[model samples]
Target: MDALEARVHRQLERMRELADRMAAVRVRETSADGVVTAVVDGNGALVDLELSDGVAELSPTDFEQTLVSTAASAARRAFAERGALVTGFNEEAAEDG
Candidate 1:
């Protein structure tokens, strides 16, 4: 292959590797009171949630607020991680170019 073709192939391989790494990313966050915990994927999609028995004591409104906030925090963390991965990939590609 020509130099340009080789470079393109390398970049495509890097992108696929990035996609695989991103797919494996996950972030977990827990509420301050430890009543709720959430896990989110790289795309900020909730993958799992956990609630402690302490949640039983919370009012419906409080419980809802806690769950939502915890999940949001987890999603935010996941997004941040994803951004870091992308940033690193871009930096590597720039160096290669």
Candidate 2:
């Protein structure tokens, strides 16, 4: 209702925009054998996967599970990094405040 609240709201909106941009990013993780790699979006959506014959040779169930887990892990890391960026932005805002 007041000016200060309005200012805070604007800042939060800016932060959200930054978060959205950060979430749109992409990151990758590779399997131990380097035979499989997973790509995930900033929000942890599995976008693409690269698997070599070595990886394909594995039993289908286990190979698929590993790929899925690795993709999830990559997504988790991307989120963690995004969180860190948000924390950094908040810290900067606090200092400015």
Candidate 3:
């Protein structure tokens, strides 16, 4: 490989490192009315979940599933947004370097 290519690759590696460092963060999310809450990692893994007592009182067969799904989706969305920020930070850093 040539010098320029090698340098670019190094820069990209740095960018990836930055992304990885920021990626393992845990994020918490909740439903619109704060009834359901979920914790997710930067990889969008659902690490923890919590339901309000009020929600438990409702007692619908599918309600729990639906709330969990909703919370997961919200966490995923938050992760994606954070990932985008990381990507942008990498790009800017690369440019500056």
The models' CA-based lDDT, in order, is 0.93, 0.84, 0.74
Tell me the tens digit of each residue's lDDT in model 3 across 1-97: 6988988887788768777767766777777666678887777778787877768665575567667776678677767877777778768776867
Q: Model 3: how large is the Cα RMSD against the reference?
A: 4.0
Task: Provide the global lDDT of candidate 3 against the true structure.
Answer: 0.74
lDDT (Cα, tens digit) per residue for candidate 1, span 24-69? 9999999999999999899888899899999989999999999999
In terms of lDDT, the best-performing candidate is 1
lDDT of 2: 0.84
Report model 3's TM-score to 2 decimal places. 0.60
Q: Compose the digit string of candidate 2's lDDT tens values, residues 1-97.
A: 6988998888988778887879677889998877779998878888898988797578989898888788888989888888877788888888868
Looking at candidate 1, what is the lDDT of residue 95? 100
Which is better, 1 or 2, measured by TM-score?
A: 1
- Which candidate should be chosen as best, given TM-score against the real structure? 1
Give all TM-scores, in the order shown. 0.93, 0.75, 0.60
- Order the candidates by lDDT, highest first — what do you get? 1, 2, 3
Q: Rank the candidates by TM-score, best first.
A: 1, 2, 3
